[model samples]
Target chain A: MKKVAIGIDIGGTNSAIGIVDEVGTVLTRGNIPTDRHSDINLYIDDLAAEIERIIASTDVELDIQGIGLGAPNGNYYNGTIEFAPNLRWKGVVELTKLLSERFNYPVIKLTNDANAAALGESIYGCAKGLKNYIMITLGTGLGSGVVINGDLVYGHDGFAGELGHVCVENGGRECGCGRLGCLETYCSATGLVRTAYELLGKSNKPSVLREVVNTEKLTSKLIYKYAIEGDALANECFRFTAEKLGKALADFTTFSSPEAFILFGGLANAGDLLIKPTKEYMEANMLEIFKNKVAIKPSELPGADAAVLGASSLVWKELSK
Target chain B: MKKVAIGIDIGGTNSAIGIVDEVGTVLTRGNIPTDRHSDINLYIDDLAAEIERIIASTDVELDIQGIGLGAPNGNYYNGTIEFAPNLRWKGVVELTKLLSERFNYPVIKLTNDANAAALGESIYGCAKGLKNYIMITLGTGLGSGVVINGDLVYGHDGFAGELGHVCVENGGRECGCGRLGCLETYCSATGLVRTAYELLGKSNKPSVLREVVNTEKLTSKLIYKYAIEGDALANECFRFTAEKLGKALADFTTFSSPEAFILFGGLANAGDLLIKPTKEYMEANMLEIFKNKVAIKPSELPGADAAVLGASSLVWKELSK
Candidate 1:
């Protein structure tokens, strides 16, 4: 019989479940649409049913050791999911209790998606054997997970490592978190598009972006494409984004002093276009004590497998601990 | 018979040695001038002699279990003091090995003066029972120590928590570390004097400060005195320092999510004059998730004893671990 644990990555829109072994290999996986009902209990019930069905269909005889979950606003200390902004859940939800009752084994753990991804990197990706590192996810909004002293820096309230919200430029841009000049407001995918629009207003650089602007459609992918084709405005947007990201990272280095920083998610796919400038500026701005010592690299994990492996590996890692 | 450890805090000018018990009590203490000899071995010989003399003079019947030394550039992992600018020592000095040879017992220890103070706070002072907090020392230079997950955040190569070097303003002020606009260049006692001189250049509103334009004549204590007498420029200097400090702290909160921040050193004696503005601005600038949640407070330990207690506490804490 194979020993495995069930890993669940619960997003605001969808949920994914996978059977993962000790070495972080996924055997089988399934997904379900997240119901946005006011009652969180109903949502948990629906998720439990879907998980039971997936387990019943799998032919491999497996001893399911536990379950690990990753969700927005998930508290590792309390095993509860607090009021996640993107989700319809109003108050705190005791997820571990409900899931453990259904599984009949330990519903082992919970952490925010960013921390989960960081754990995945530490356990099975580029950050292997590294005691100190920061995992940055540049998606809809920037998110980060900090590792210090060979363990996750959970802080006093399990809310540490909120690096995206750190104010980089004072009074520069408005953020979804209702803050002024947060790092995410100027560095994420949306931030890149916003920069492209600002560049358009400043200079009349005749380029392919002008056509996209006329259609009222602009995305980071579109901007990246135009920049690669030698569009001046689009290239400037990437340079501006990398500048802000590098300076902010230099400041963060003073606090945690990680060995390296691993970039993940959609925007990170831009590769050297983003990494080169960021590395240049970060090294230029970093303290002399930290200069030429820290490494800045992209995520090595496969994207589709990252979230599931990260969420599931939390159970395996915790159980072994 | 009781068991004890000898804790040594080596500074640029002087060094403090104490025999500490498990309950954070300094049974006996001694001080000696830091001899800056060209040979590293000579300095170690002097240090060992001082320890032997202090031990022989004490009548207390206690078994010395180990020794802990805190220096300027102490590396906990390598057990060596790296190139410390203030000290005459260059390159790596293996003080741990020398101390162990003299005592004939394992000298289990590590970290610098700033981190030692943080350990002291965690084990004996206001941060007792707390897992995450930052300790800032406002002496000749600004020093910081970060605690995450109940341990000192020593990043790769043991050089984490250089908060003083984090940039507060771009191209604002030149720092000793060859960085532009570092936080310590604007927040420490020396920084306060520099700010007063800069304010003198920018503003006409002044009282007694005009007479003292040179930094050699100006002191942080004198600046506080003038500010107490309602000098607008002097008060503005403190406010400016506090604002920069508070904003920087808000940035740190995003990474560490600490319970509280403890301030130590001579400048911390400014009390509410410094604490009030820092608390106000820090709260005002923090993210909604952290608003009014973390405390900005003063250190409870006395200045003279805090470093010694902190250095000693490192042994007890590490032994317990």
Candidate 2:
């Protein structure tokens, strides 16, 4: 019988559930609309049923491991989701407990999506055999997971590794979190678009980005598209974003001298366009001892199913411990 | 038999050696001048002799545990002192290997002084039972040891937790490490004196610090003396230093979210004078979740013997592991 763990990736609009094997293969998967369920218990019941249905769809006889969850503001210690603004359910929700009651699993683990991504990288991706590394996910907003000596840093409050909020340029940019000059304000996917607009406003360079700068369709994906087509302004946006990110990583080295920093999510898909410049700027700003050491690379997880793979890998990691 | 460990605190001018019991009592201790030894081997021999003399002087039949040494640039993984600028030795010193050859010990451990201090706090000082905290030592230069989940963060190369080198400003103050805007340049003991001079030169204020600012007589100690006596310029210096430290601590929160930040060394002796304002500024600058949660407290280790106790506690910490 194939041993499998149920992975749940909870998002603001939709939640993906999957049955994953030990080797990181998703046997079966489905999604549930989260925004429609305002009631926490109703959402939990729907999520649990979707997970069971997905497991039953698998042809192989499965020996069920446990369930692992990844969501915004997920707390590992208490197994609660506290005040996550993106989720429709308000206040604290005992997510792991509610879901566990429906299944006969031995353990249920939950952490923020970024930390799950880090665990996934450690177990089945580029960070394999590397005990110290940081996983950076650059989606709409930036998220991070700091791994040291092969364990995720949960910190005292189970809320460590919020590297996105680290101030990069004090009082420089306003963040949604009501902070000024957060790293995420300049380095996330949206941050790339913001950079595009800033560069578009500054220079009179005739470029492809000028056609889309005032449009609602200006996205990091579009910027990536133009940059690949050799558009000057679009290419400059990536350079500007990478420089800020690289400088921040250099400062982060002083806290934990990780072996590498793995980039994931939308902006990371730009590949060498992002990683190359980030590596150079990081080396330039790093202290002499850390220079030419830490590697900056893109995440190796399969793009479309990365979140599900990360969520399920959490079970394997906990079982190993 | 009573269990004891040898602790060696190697400094630029002098080295202190002590035989400490499992309960953190220093049974007997001695010192050797580190600057007098031009050769690394000669220094190791003298350090070994001092340890033996201290152990022999103890009255009880002691079961020697192991030896732990704390020095500038000490590497725990390699057990060597690598390019310590203040020491008379020019290159890497194999102090642990040579000392281990003379002593028939079960284990020998070495780490930078700040890390050792953190271990001492965890085992025998105020940080007892606290799994997550950071120890900041504000001596001639700023040094820090970050403890997370009950272990010192010894990243990939065992040179992690160099928080003093974290850049607080982009291109502000020049540091001895040839870097600009390092936290140490504005927050250490010398940093405090520098702040005093900066304030003194900025305005022609009628104050006690004005009398000594022109002379090479200004010190953090003198500043503290006058601040307690209600001198405006002297008080401003402490407040200024605390604000920088507090803001830096706020940024550090995003990385580790430690329970408390324990302050040590000369400037930290100001007690509430430094701790109060630092706590306030840290709270003001902190993220909502971390605000009012992390404490800024003075070190609880007895001042004169802190370095030696910290070194000896390393053996106890290792033995428990």
Candidate 3:
């Protein structure tokens, strides 16, 4: 019988479930609407049923190993998801305890989506054999997972590695966290569009982005589309984003001196359009000994399978331990 | 026979040698001039002789366990002192290898002085029983050692925890490291003097400090004296230094969420004058989750014996591991 681990990605809108084997192969996948179930017990029941249905449909004889989850505010230490703003389940939800009771599984690991991505990258992706590196997810808000000496830094509380919240411009931009000049305010996917708007307001530069200015349609994807086509103002937005991220990365080097920084999520898909300038600015701002040492690379995990693979890798990591 | 470890604290001017037992008592102590010996071999020979003399002077029968060193720019991985600006040795000096060979001792550990302080605090000082904390030494230049999960964060390379070089204000002050606006440039013993000078230059509201302004007699000690005596400008210097340090500590909290920040060295000796304002500013600048969570306290290690004790603790830590 083939041993398999359950991988679940809990998003605000929907939850993705996948049965993954030892080698990161997703055998069967399914999804359920997370927003529809306001009640915690019903949500867990529905999730359990979905997993059972997926397992029953699979042809191979499978022995279930354990379950691993990637959620918005997942705490690895407490096995709970606490006060995630986008999730309907308010306060601390005993996610792992509830799910473990349903499945009767002895091992269940949970961490934030960014830390999960770091584990996946370490176990199966580009960061293999690297003991120290940082995983940065440039999504709606910048999220990060710092790996040092092959273990994730959980800090005193489980809330370490919030690199997105690190101040870059010292009161330049306002953040959702009620802080001034957070790196996320200028470096995330939403931040790219905000940068485009700021560039449009400040200068009379001729560009394709001008047409979508002040509209709800101003998005990072739109900015990337114009940037690839050589729109000067759109390209400048990426440059500005790189400038903030690059400087922040340089400052981060003085703390951990990580081997590399792995970029994940939507903005990272822009490839060299973003990575090239970020590396340049990081090098320019870096201290002497750290210069040209830390590499900034895009995530090597396949975009479609990354979320499930990351979640599954947690189980594999625990088993190996 | 009592088990004792040899502790060597290498400074720019002098080297202090101590023989310490497991319970943190200094059995016998002596010193040698570090600046007098430009040749590395002669320096090693003298240091070895000093250690031997100190060990022989102890009244109790002792078995030497190991020797540990704390020096500027000391690298734990390489066990060498590399490019220490204050030291006469230009390049990487193989101090550990040379000394170990001289003493024929197999176990010799070396790291930067701040890291030693952290190990000392963890083993014997106020930070006992704490698994996570940061050690900040506010000297001529600021130095730091970060502890996470009961172990020091050494990063990928041996050169982790160089928090002194982390920038506070972009392009604000010129640092000796050829960087602009490093934390050390605004918050160290020298930084306090620099702040006092700046305050003196800008505002004429200063009383006592103006007499010593631009003179060689200007020092952090003088500033502390005037501040305690109700000098407004002198107090402002402490406040400004606290502002930069407090904000930087808040940013650092986002990275490693340590339980406490233990302050060491001369500037930190101002007690409530610096700690009070620093805690206030750190709390004001901190994120919601970390607010009122991290304590800012002075180091409990005796000022006279701290260096040697810190060095000796390195041996104890390694042995237990």
Candidate 4:
């Protein structure tokens, strides 16, 4: 029988679970609404049942091995999720302890969602065999994972690599984290939409984006579609986003000089529209020593399953440890 | 027999050599002028001879272990000094190989000056038990050493922690590194002097600092003296320095959330005048998750022997590796 790991990636609105084999193949997977279950115990109970049902439905003869989970504010050190703003579970939630009680697994590991992404990329994606690099997930918000000397930088309090909150413009834009001039306010997918609307009003450039009735419903993908069609305002919005991202990257390089920055998520799919300008602006801002050295590339992992696979990859890391 | 290592600290104008034991004690040390020899080979020969003299003059029964060196732009991976602006030797110079050949001791190791300081702090100072902290030496120029998970962050290249070069003001001040608004421009000893002049012109407040005959020769010590004497302009200058330093520290915490920042050099000797205001300002700028958590403290290592002792700690790290 083939040994397999259970990988669970939990987010604010969704929870994805996958039964993965050694080579990173997801034999079976399922998604459940994360925010629907306000009661903590009921959510865990339903999740346990769904995982059991998925394992039973699979045709492959598999030996259950270990479990790994990635979630917001997940603590690998103490195995608890502390004060995560998005979670319905208030204060400290011992998700590991609750899940382990329902399963016969000997090893159950947990880490922040971004850390799992970093490990996943290093083990199964574009960052394979590379030790020094940064993995950034630019979605509703920007998430970053810093790998130095081939290990995740979990500082004294297990809360390192918060590059999104690093200010790009002093007192510029108000962040959701309640700070001014955060990189997240200018570089995230939502930030792209915010830029789109800002530029929509700031300039009089004729574009397809102007036809959209609901500006609040505007998504990064829709903006990318318009930009691909040579819409001037949409292209300018992406250019604006890349400029802030590049400037922040230049400052970040001065800290731990990474070999590359692997971008993942919705905005990254825009391809040359974002990457080309981001690299151009980053190189323009960096010191001559750091110029033209760091590569900015998109993550190779499949977008739909990347988070689940990344969460699963944590088991391999823990096993080796 | 007592095992001892030879420690050499190469600087722009001076080089210090010492025989250090495993416990980070400097047995005997001497200084040699560094820039006097413009030729790299002559400089290496003189340094090796001085190291030999220091080792021979020691009275204790000692078994020579190995050698360690700390220099600007020292590569831990290559054991060579590359493109050090402060050094007279311009391009890549194999200082470690030459010294190792001159003295037949094996296990020669090299790291940047700030990295050496970090190792010294972890091994011999307040951070003996702490695995994660940042050690900053605020001398004529600013230097930083990042300790993560009990090791110095030597990234893809041997150069990783260059916090001094990170932009704080964002096109606010021109730095010697050809960058504008570097943290070093406002935080170093020379930066304090620059702050004094800027404040002198901006303020109408009476100050003892006005009595200085040569403004160009003004020092951080002089500024601290006037600040202590209740001079409002000097007090404002110190406050100005702390505010910049604090804001940068808050921003830096977002990168690697160290437990504390261990400060060294002449400016740090001012005690509460700099530390208190810096702490207040840093906490003010930080995101809520990082506020009031990181400590900023003075270095406990003796000033005279710190560089030599720090350089010597590299051998211990190598032996473990």
lDDT of 2 by residue, B155-247 (tens): 898789898988888787999988888999999889998898788779788898876767758878889999999999889988999999998
User: What does candidate 3's lDDT look like per residue over B1-321, in tens digits?
Assistant: 999888889999999988888988898999999998789998888887888787778789988889989999899988999889899999999988888788765469999999999999998799999988999999999889999889888777787888998877877799888888889999999999889878888997947888767565899999999899999999999999888889999999988889999999999899989999999999998987788999998999889999999999889988989
lDDT, residue B125, candidate 3: 93
Residue B114 displacement in candidate 2 (angstroms): 0.2
For residues B230-288, write the lDDT of model 1, one tens digit per residue: 88888998998899889988888989899999999877889878988998989888977
Q: Candidate 4 recovers what fraction of true contacts?
A: 0.78
Off by over 4 Å in 2: none
Give me the overall lDDT of model 2.
Answer: 0.89
Q: Would you estimate the TM-scores of all the predictions? A: 0.95, 0.97, 0.97, 0.96
Q: What is the lDDT of residue A279 in candidate 4?
A: 93
Report the C-alpha displacement of residue B270, candidate 1, in angstroms.
1.0
Off by over 4 Å in 3: A214-216, B214-216
Model 2 docking category: medium
Q: Determine which window of 10 residues in candidate 1 chain A has minimal summed lDDT.
A: A99-108
Instruction: Assess the local accuracy of residue A169 in candidate 3 as a C-alpha lDDT between 0 and 100.
Output: 74
lDDT agreement of model 4 with the native: 0.86
Please write out the lDDT profile of model 3 over residues A104-215, one tens digit for every residue.
7657989888888999899879999999899999999998999988888888888888889888878678998898989999999999988987988899988877776656
lDDT values, one for every candidate: 0.85, 0.89, 0.89, 0.86
Which pairs clash in model 3?
none
Q: Is candidate 1 or candidate 2 better by DockQ?
A: 2
| TM-score of model 1 vs. true structure | 0.95
* lDDT of model 3 at position B281: 91
